[model samples]
Target: MTTAEEIIAHLRSLRNQRNIDGMRRFGIAPTGEQLGIAAPVLRAIAREHRRDHELALALWSSGIHEARGLATLVEDPRQVTRGQAERWVRDCDNWAATDALAFLLDRTPFAEEKAHAWSTRKAEFVKRAAFSIMAGMAVHRKELPDSVFLGFLPVIARESTDERNFVRKAVNWALRQIGKRNARLLGAAIAQGVKIQRLDSRAARWIAADALRELRSRR
Candidate 1:
């Protein structure tokens, strides 16, 4: 068994100060220990270890940015509980960590429920997680019906006025991903974007314009 300490040490060995600086430049200011390791490298390391629910929990508890990311990759979706998802989401301080965690959570059965619940949160990152999870589901969960995503459009429109950079970007991402899912969804998303365009807020207009452009281009 690869111990969490051993994994942490290995991650340290792979750290690059330049990458850490680069990450900071990109706004990935991890709240805990940030090794500055690139995501692809961490993903390759995760592929080696595969699923280890316990190890994933330990890694996440370590508060190392890359370790938490690795935890998401190695976590067994079946073992992921709603409580664990909620706990980890509250710890998210950056887009990279939040998006990675959301992607992992999207694989769990609790995804849809959490997506709607978290989007209503006032915290910047928590609300972003909601839309991030929706984007992940749109990309990965092929079995989900169009209605599942369509139901999210109203939430997207309602939250489109959120002027936070992370929140609005995520809202746009979810809208675009959902629209790209299929022809039916594409039409629905475009219509929703048009409605969002009618809103007075700058954020809503931006979200609507961007989503409509992409959704229309895909048609």
Candidate 2:
């Protein structure tokens, strides 16, 4: 069996000196002095232990910034549990890690329920993850009803007032993705943007204004 320690050691060995500084320059804080390994290297690590859920969990829980990056490379999202997914989001302190794990989870079977449930979470990133999942599904899950996308409008309206950098960004992302899907949704999104602009909060105003501009565009 591939051991978690062995996997971490392998990841450590593959660390690229140049990439760690680049990651920090990009605003991802490093937990230590050494630069983290690249995604291709991490993906190669994940490929070796593809069937070992326990090993994968062990590698993820090790909490190196890049380790979580590797966690996303876990070819089978089903092998991961809700607890694991939720925990990863909670542990996320940066946008890159948060989106990486979210992208992985969004591709899985349980994505819809989890996305809707987490959008209601009080925690910023958890809610952000939920909305991010919705954004991904907007493009990928074509079988879903338009009503499902419509249902998220209320959450976006309520959460648009969230002034936190990450949360509002995800809210904007979800709204933009939904608006771009079709002409009818574009109109609905424009209406919602108007409503959001009228809110008392500055964050809400910006979100509404930004969304309205692009949503009204012909692209």
Candidate 3:
């Protein structure tokens, strides 16, 4: 039972001011006691305490940005719950943390449910998590039938109008990933992309054009 404090203490030792400054230039704003640790280092730490659910929870409660990212890595998907997912997502203040949470949450049993629930969320990071999870699932969840992703096409189309940079990028990621999954979904995602292209919003057209470019080239 490695304690969260001990791990966070270790994280503090690995902090890099250069890394922190570099991350900020890419829109990864500092949030809550960030230690300026690189992601690969955190991932290595998580591997050390893999599947430590209690430790993950405690780290998350600490409200340290990198600790929260490490929490996502160390958590057991089997132990994750809807309540925890909601709580952690609401804590996400940056795109990096949001993507870390999405990467882990996408492996949970209730990922699809949370994806839909969070997609319509008012919070920018929360909404980004929804599609980030969707994008991850498309790449990794092979056992899930195509119908699951097919159902997601409409949601992707609907959300394409979001003008926020993070949300639109994630929406495009989800669409492109789904189209790459299989021939059937490729056709479906492409059609959805074309429909999205017709939407009045600038964000929608950008999302559609980017997704359609890759998806069409693949066809």
lDDT on C-alpha atoms for all candidate structures:
0.94, 0.78, 0.92
- Candidate 1 vs 2: which has more lDDT: 1
Runs with alpha carbons beyond 4 Å of true place in candidate 2: 1-3, 30-34, 40-52
Kindly list the per-residue Cα lDDT of model 1 for residues 102-175, writing each as its tens digit. Answer: 99999999899999999999999999999999999999999999999999999999999999999999999999
Ranking of candidates on lDDT, top first: 1, 3, 2
* Model 2 agreement with the true structure over 1-219: per-residue lDDT tens digits: 666687677777777867877887886774533446776776776776665666657756787887767767763677778877878788877777777877788778888788889878888778889888878878777787788778878788988888888889898888988888778777778888899999999999989988888988854
Output the number of the TM-score-best candidate: 1
Off by over 4 Å in 3: none
Error of 1 at 132 (Å): 0.4
The TM-score of candidate 2 is 0.84
Worst 10 residues of 3 by lDDT: 30-39
lDDT value, candidate 3, whole model: 0.92
Q: Could you tell me how far off, in angstroms, the CA of residue 31 lies in candidate 3 after the best superposition?
A: 2.6
Q: 1-219, model 3: which lDDT tens digit per residue?
A: 678889888888888888888888999984688778888888888788899899999999999889999999989999998999998899899999999999999899999999998999999999999999999999889999999899889999999999999999999999999999999999999999999999999999999999999999997
Quality of model 1 by C-alpha lDDT: 0.94
